[model samples]
Target chain A: MTIKQIERLRKGAITLLMLAISILFLLPFLWMLSASFKIEADVFTYPIQWIPAKWHIIENYKEVWIGKFPFYKYYWNTVKVTVLTTVTSAFVSALAAYGFSKINFAASKYLFIIVLATYMIPHQAILVPQFILYRQIGFFDSHLGLILLSSFSVLGTFMLRQFFMGVHNEYIESAKIDGAGHWRIFWQIAFPLVRPAVATYAILRFIWTWNDYQNPLIFLRTDKLYTIQLAMQKFTTINGEFYSLIMAAAVSAILPLLIVFIIGQKSVIEGIALGGVKG
Target chain B: MQKLETAAEAPKAKHISKRSSLQKKETIAGLLFVGPMLIGVTVLTFIPIIATFLLSLADWNFIAGFKDIKWVGFDNYERLLQDDGFMKSLKNNAYFLLTVPIYLAISMLLAILIDKHVYMKSYFKVAYFMPYISSIVAVAIVWQVLFHPSAGPVNQLLISFGIDNPPKWIADPKYALPSLMMISIWISIGFNLIVYIAGLQSIPKDLYEAADIDGANAWHKFKSITFPQLSSTSFFLLVTGIISTFKIFDLIAILTKGGPISSTSMLVWHLYDTAFVNLKIGYASSMAVILFACVMLITVLQWLGQKKWVNY
Candidate 1:
C-alpha cells in the first residue's frame, strides 16, 4: 500500500477502536434509560434487553413522582441548597479574591497559602468536629447550616484569586486614580473581567452541592429536608424489592443536573481545561 | 528669604507625605476583604482539625455531652491498632490503591489513542465523558440493577453462553470491592482522559517534527517524545487519583454500605459508621486523623518524587 493508504488504514482502525470503547462507557447509561421503561419484572430478564418489550414510562414517572417517594420535594431541596450555596460562595470568593490579588497587604501571601492548604485537607477528616460544633451551635439539621457549610469554599477562593490576578492592573490603577475606592475598583473593573471564571466556578459549585450526599445524610434527619441523593438512598428498604421504582427515582434525581450540565457544558469543559493548564 | 521659604516648604511636604500614605489604608482594606474567609477557615476548618486531634484523645459520645468525657490518651489509637475492622479497612484501601493505577493507565492510553486519531474526536470525547457527568448515586443504582445475580443481564448473558453460576456482584463479599473499583474506574476515566488530552495538545509540535526528520517510527517517536513530555501530567493524575481513591466513601455508601461481611468497607466508610451509626465520635476521630496522616504522607512522597520525573 502507498503511504497515504497506510495512514488512512491507521486512522480507520483507530476510529473503530474508539467507537468500541465509547460504547463501553455509554452502555450503563443506555441500559438505565432502557430499563426505566421496562416492566418491573422484565427489568431483570435475561440477555439484558436493549429495548423494553412493554413501555412503562408513564407508570414509572407517576410512581416516582408522587407514589411512595416525595421525589419532587427532594428535588426542590436540592435546588434550594445548590442555588444558595453556589451563588453565595461565588460572590464571597470573588470579593475575597479581589482582596487577595489586587490590594497590597502585610501577611497576605502567607494568609492566602493558609486558605489553599485548607483545601488539601480531606473534607471528611474534619466531619466529626464540625458536626459537634454545629450541634453545639444549634445549627444542626437546619438548611441554613447546610448552606453555610457548603458556601464556605476555599477552592473557589483560590480559583477566583488566580482569575482576578490575571486582570490587567492598568484598569484598577486608572479606577483608583479616579477616586474610586477598593470596593468600587473591584466591582466595576475586576468583576467584569473575570465573569467567565465566576460563571465556571458557579456551575461547578452548583453541581457539587446538588450531588452532595454525605453532608445532607449526616445533618438532615427529617425526610422533609432530604436532598435528592438522600432521597434516592431511601428508595430501597430492608427485605423489599423495588428496582423499577428506584431506577425511576434515580433518573429523576439526575435529570436536573443533566439539564444544567448540558446547558453550561461548553463553558464547564473550557473552565476545567483552563484550570488544568494553569495549574 | 529663599532659605526660610525652603525650610517652611520642607515641613509642609513632610505633612503631605504622611497624609498620603495609601499603604496602611490598602492593608486594612485587604484584611477587610479577606476577613470573612479567614474567620470562616479559622473557626470551621483550622480549629476543627486541631479539635479532631484533641477529640481523638477522649471518649466523648454526643449523647453524653462534654461532661461524660474521659481522657484516654493513646487508648483509642491502641484500640484502633487492635481492631479487626480497622485492619480490614486498611487492607481494602490498599486494594483500592492497587486498582486505581490500572484505571489511570487505561484512561491515559485511551486518551492518547483519541489524540492520535483525529476524526470523530469530539464525539468520542463526549461519549466517554457522559458517565463522569452523571451523579454517582444514580450510576451506582444502575450498576446494582445490571449486576443482579439471577435475572440480571450479566448472569443471563453468561447462562446463554453455557455457564450456570455467576458471582453476586455487590452482594458477594469477594466481588463487592472489585465491583466498586470497576464503577470508580468508569467514573474517573473521563476526568483523567480530559487532562491527558490537554497534556497531549500542549506538547510542542517541533518535537514531533524533529522525530520525523530522524526517521523515527511511531512507537519510537512516542516513547522518546510523548511519554517524556506527559510525565508531569501523569504525576498529577497519580497523586490526585491515589488521594481520591483513598477517600472512597460515596459509592460504598450507596451500593453495599460496606456489606457482605465488611469486605468492601474502607477507612472512610468505617469512620462514618462509627461516628454516625455507633456514635463513637472519639474513636472515629482517631480514624480520621490516621486517614489524614496517610493522605498527607502520600502527597508529600509524591511531591518529593516529582523532582525526578516532572520537567517543569
Candidate 2:
C-alpha cells in the first residue's frame, strides 16, 4: 500500500475503533433505557435483549410514576429542594464571591481562605454533628431543611469568585461613583457580569441536590417528605425484585438530568473543565 | 474673611467625608456580601468540625439530651486502633483507591482517541458522562438489575462462555467489593475523561507536529510530550478520584448494604453504619475525625508532592 493510502486506512480504522468503544462504554445506559421499556420477564431474560420484544414503555413508566408508590411526590420534593437550593445557593455564593473578589477588606481575604479550606473537609466528617444540629433546630426531615443545608456551598462560592475576579474593577468603581451602593453594585454590575458562571454553579447545584443520597438518607425520615434519593432507596430496596419497575423508576429519576445533560452539554461539560471540579 | 476660608475648607471636608464613607461602605459591604457565607461556614462547617472533634472525645449515642454526655478523651481514638471493622473499612477504602489508576488510564486513552479522531465528540462525552450526572440512587438501582444473580446479562454472558457458577456479583462476599469498585470506576471515568480531554486540548499542536516530523512513534510522543503535559491534570484526578472513591457510600447503600460480611464497607459507609444505623455516635465521630485527618493529610502530601513532581 502507498504511504498516503496507509494513513487513510489507519484513520478509518481509528474511527471504527472509537465508534465501537463508545457504544461499549454506553452499554450501561443503553441497557438501562432498554430495560426501562421492557416487561418483568424480559428484563433479565437470556441472550441480553437489546430491545424489548413487547414494549411496555407506558405500562412501566405509569407503574413507576403513579402506580402504588406514586413517585411524583418525591419528584416534586426533589424539584422543590433542587430549585430552592440552586437559586439560593447561587445568590448567596455570588454575594460571597463578589465580596471576596471585588471588595477590598482584610477580613474578606482571611474569610475566603477559610471558606476555601472548608471545601477540603468532606461533608461526611461534619455530617454527624450537622445531623444533631439540624435535629436541634427542627430542620430535619423537611424539604426546607434540605434547602437550608445546601443553600450555600464553598465550591460554588469559590468557582464564582474566579469568575467574579475576571470582571473589571472599573465597572464596579464606575458604578460606585454614580452613588450605587454595595448591594446595587453587586446586583447591577458584578452579578450580571458573572451571570453565566452563577448559572453554571446553579445548574450544577440543581443536579447535585437532585442526585444527593447521603443527606436525604440521614435527615429525611418520613416518606411523605422524602426526596427522590430517599424515595428511590425505599423503592429499590423493597422492589428490587421487579427489574422492570426498578429500571422504570431509575429512568424517571434520571430522565430530567439526562435531558439537562443533553441540552446543556456544553455548559455542564465546560463547567467541570473550567475548574476540574465535578458537581 | 470667614466666607473665603469656609469656601476653601468645604471641598476638603467633602473629599474627606467621601473617602471615609467609601472605606466604611467597603467594610460594611464586604461584611454584608460575605455575611451569609460567614454564618454558613461557622454554623455548618466550622462548628460541626469542632463538635465532631469534641463528640469523638466523648461517649454519646445521640439519644439523650446534653446532660447525658460523658467525657472520655482519647478512649474513642484508642478503640479505633482495635476496631477491626474500622481497619477493614480503611482497607476497603485503600482497595477502592485502585480505581484511580484504572480511571486515569481509561480516561487518558479515550480522551486522546476522541481528541484525535472523533468527529462527533459531544455524543461520546454525554454517553459516558450520563452515569456521572445521574442520581446515584438511579445508577445503583439500574446496576442492581444488571448485577442480578441468576438471570442478569453479565452472568448470562459468562454462562454463554461456559463458565458456570459465576460469582453472584453484589451478593458474593468475594466479589462484592470488587464489583462495587468496578461501578465506581465506571462512574469516575466520564468526569476524568472530560477533564483529560480538556487537558489534552490545552497542549499546543506544534509539539505533536514536531514529533511527527522527527518520526517519533506514538508511544514516545505521548510519554515525553503528552504525558508530561498532562501531569497536573492527572495529579488532580488522582487526588480527587482517590478521595471521592474512598467515600463511596450511596452505591454500596443501594446495591450491597456493605454486603455479605462488610466486604464493600468503606470508610464513609462504616461511619454511616456506626453513627446512624448502629447509633454509636461517638465511635462514628472518631471515624469521621480519622477520615478528615486522612483526607487532609493526603491532600497536603499531594499538594507538596505536586511542587516536586507535577509539571504545574
Q: Candidate 2: what's its TM-score on chain B? A: 0.94
Q: Which pairs in model 2 have colliding backbones?
A: none
- lDDT, candidate 1, at A108: 94
**Per-residue alpha-carbon lDDT of model 2 for A13-62, expressed as tens digits?**
88777788777667877888898899888887788888889999999889
CAPRI grade of model 2:
medium
Model 1 lDDT at residue A118: 86
Candidate 1's residue-wise lDDT over A1-279, tens digit each?
999999989999889978987888888888878877878888777667778899999998788888767578888888888899899889878888988999988879999999888877888999999999999999889898898886768878888999999988889898888999998888888899999899988988887787788899888888899888888887755213767777777778777777887888776666666565211
Output the number of the DockQ-best candidate: 2
DockQ of 2: 0.76
For model 2, how does the per-residue alpha-carbon lDDT over B1-312 read when each residue is reduced to its tens digit?
999999999999999999889788789989999999889889998999999999999998788778889999999999999999889989988888888899799989999988876556777787678778988888877777678788778888889999989989999989898898888878888899999999998999999999999999989998999999999999988888878875678888888787688888889989999999888889899999999998898899897998888974
Q: Report the poorest 10 consecutive residues by lDDT, candidate 2 chain B.
A: B115-124
